[model samples]
Target: MDFFARSLAIAGLSVSLAACAGAPAQSRPAAVAQTAAAPPPMAPPGPCALRPSCDTPFPAPSKREFRHNRSGLLASALGPRHRGRDLFLLPGTPQWVLGKFAYGPADKDLKDEDIDVYLLRGCGAAWEKVGTYRTTEDEGSHPAVVGVADEGGQIFVNLAQVLPGGPLGVGRHRIKMVVAGDGTSVDLFLEVLPAGARIVVTDIDGTLTEKEEALVGDVLTGNHSQTHPGAVDVMRSLSGRGFFMFYLTARPHWLEPRTREWLRLRGFPPGIVHTSVTATGRMGGAAASFKSGELSLLKTATGLLPELAFGNMPSDVDAYWSSGIPRTFYYKLADDARGGVKHDDYRTLLPSLGELPAVCP
Candidate 1:
């Protein structure tokens, strides 16, 4: 059988074993009891009698309130000193305004002369310039203001206030900030999230493995393709702490079973596995657009919003950034070859295996 088919078979076996292990035990009956006989069957009711009138009132809307903190942590081990905020928006709500852009010290060193924020929705071909604000100096504590300005420091237009509108929908939204100074610009995107959902999506290849190249040579054929140190323990701890975990990859669907089995063997829990459509081609890194689309679809199917994401590639960052989810924990192999110990964002790194925190509020 091909790799995918074999993997499916293995998954089936594992599922069967899991089912058996979960079967409920039977209870013993009481000793010696006298029983009575049953009565004969009666005639069926007439059609008119069977069709009894019943008025079912519409159920009242649920009153339970959904509450969650709107704050989140931003950690980057890459040393650039990342800073950002987490805004909580209602699912399906229309894009809300982020108010105004305040130029910071970083803006002073810009090669470009102006800064702009763009709204990228639905990972498609176009992005809308919803609002644009500029700063007088590259560095300052200027008061907040709205509207667009020209290169000569003249106000061109006043943009509308950032307001929220849209039906109840949920998922991540990415906001890209472009700072143009001198003759260059840098694009920094941050994710926004809805409340209550706490899912974690991770890529499986280089981010979690030392094999920096081809999957066939590094993972499929080599015995060295094992889980990174501390990976399994962290995953187990997260699972125990009530965080839903999933593996999202551009890997072919045919590899699902083997990949699932590999993860199971490596101590990762059984969570949803997303693979690309066969027509999309083979095991390759998905485009940021493609991953963004998948993230939307997954959000709909699972009814859970991911609060944090983890991965190592630029594309992964792009995808997560666009989805609008808050909190991203990125990692790279330590430069000194001290294994995976050294990391860029160690503040939010998983606690050591035995030191995992309790899940209680």
Candidate 2:
């Protein structure tokens, strides 16, 4: 939970305007309909309303750091230096396809670097050129019509500008960024959700993995991760039922890429991943605050709180309670009478999977 907010930021990979609030995810034979509360009166279609996702109150710190440049073997070992910030938006809101760029083993931030951007519908192999953008020195995203990256390693390629005419469509799309210097690139995701979509949000370190320190132990010892037994099947099944899976964690910013990699490696359902860039989360005692704050942003953006949530910390309980999520489960805790259920076995919920609602259009 200590790493929750930064992870939400790193793990904060998403939002869905006009999403719905509903009961805890349960299995029943009936198809359920989400209880979508009406969204705030949207500003009439205009420049402001057309804006894509932006940095929340706590935006990422875009600080440039210099390091001994790395290439080839060493660079490959440290993994991809550039990572695009994945975004989720309701159709009306355009997306600022943002990314962080760096080079070498230490992820030395790159600036004034030229990049080629491309778009691939449905993540197919065929790619289409979008534009040529440059990494500038700005920390905040104010992407021009062309596309841009800030010195803080942040890139903002506005969807309204690239795919002009309308907001990006529903379903997943890929945004590719190729560094002009090395011809190397990274692919980030853009999940465009429809109004009143159903979503399931969860934390990673403990909620998904076997325990809070499990991930750290695995990373440090170079061992395979140990996920809670049914975590994978349960999440994948939820996705199959048309529920959007949100993997919100409190990991640090730099870990976002790895976090996504781990989820993919572990067979967790595909979804946006968010990690925090804040210095105060987790051990700093801001995990709950970060989560509630982020949840509040999501509530306003999507017009609904998550229908179901999972976690394993007091902070998680606190965050969910404040967000008013109806169904929240903690893997480790006993059932709390106030709220939240004591449940961890995902397989047990499989029989009644149909009870969960299909996402609303």
Candidate 3:
């Protein structure tokens, strides 16, 4: 399907704004919506005398490094069941960036960099300074090296923790990141999804996309990324119904942008997309370790277990089962030795949604 048509089919031109307390109006799909007043101005970040403070140290990165920079902002979709009178938990969210510097014929060790973070209230609203943070330089994956090596390395800049702050006004918030060495920047949105009793986790490769013989160069090159006919639609339908959808993939971090772009081009609903920093290739046991580790981290951060999980490979079966989600609700797109009821494809299984209860009993 063409990009525009797929978008229309999955997310019709009309938007339905479901009420989510403190969630920004823009975060919802669309419908008649009310806007909440902006929160009172918070104090800006402290000024730094040095050109590169903890937040923005690397102010003049080379062009080669800038082109390959990557930044990510994420917030836990799950929040506390009850807010106590004494403790206020800032939503568990993080702002981070990954990039290289001073490109040359051969990669060299990188010095630590700095980044600045600002929180956006809304469109045209003044952005408030959150804080300045520093990156930890490390060697990233390279063709010449099996493990982390100094050559052709990348650096990681993370906020470390969500710094203490005043209560934020109810609404979606945007995080803006600026590279200190160069004037490069990226922005990401954070919103606390409405409370839902059930969460759904799905695998990307063989389950949503066409069952591939292998998922190496084909995926990285955008050559083998056709989605199943109804997979995108079903995921959208679930998201609209308030299910907290999370896309769990073992695709290496470098492939993240491409994977997300592919999903958007195919009209899949937006959700939290998790990936690994390294690859053991498709269906490797290390992938099971990565997936399960991610699931464990998700549970620890969000305090919610996914009620439903989906996958197509044996690694997926082991990962989901080990994460404490039931094998019954764990639907498989194809058969494996692990043994779960398998669906021929999403088209046949989507109808079963009507039979399932909305809230976990």
Among all candidates shown, the one with the greatest TM-score: 2
Judging by lDDT, tell me the better candidate of 1 and 2: 2
Instruction: List, residue by residue over 127-186, the lDDT tens digit for candidate 1.
Output: 555444543333233332221112222112222234233321332333344332211111
Q: What are the lDDT scores of the predictions, listed in order?
A: 0.38, 0.59, 0.45
lDDT of 2 by residue, 77-177 (tens): 32345666776677677677776766433445666556677776555555666777767555654543212224465566677667643556776777777
Ranking by TM-score: 2, 3, 1
Q: Per-residue lDDT tens digits of candidate 3, residues 47-128?
A: 2110111122223323222222332111111111100000001244433333332211111222354556665542224556
In order of listing, the candidates' clash counts read 20, 26, 18
Local error of candidate 2 at residue 153 (angstroms): 2.2
In candidate 3, position 37 carries an lDDT of 25
Segments in model 1 whose C-alpha atoms lie over 4 Å from true places: 1-197, 218-224, 279-285, 333-348, 352-361
TM-score-superior candidate, 1 or 3:
3
Candidate 3 regions with alpha-carbon error over 4 angstroms: 1-110, 120-129, 138-176, 183-197, 213-224, 279-282, 327-339, 355-361
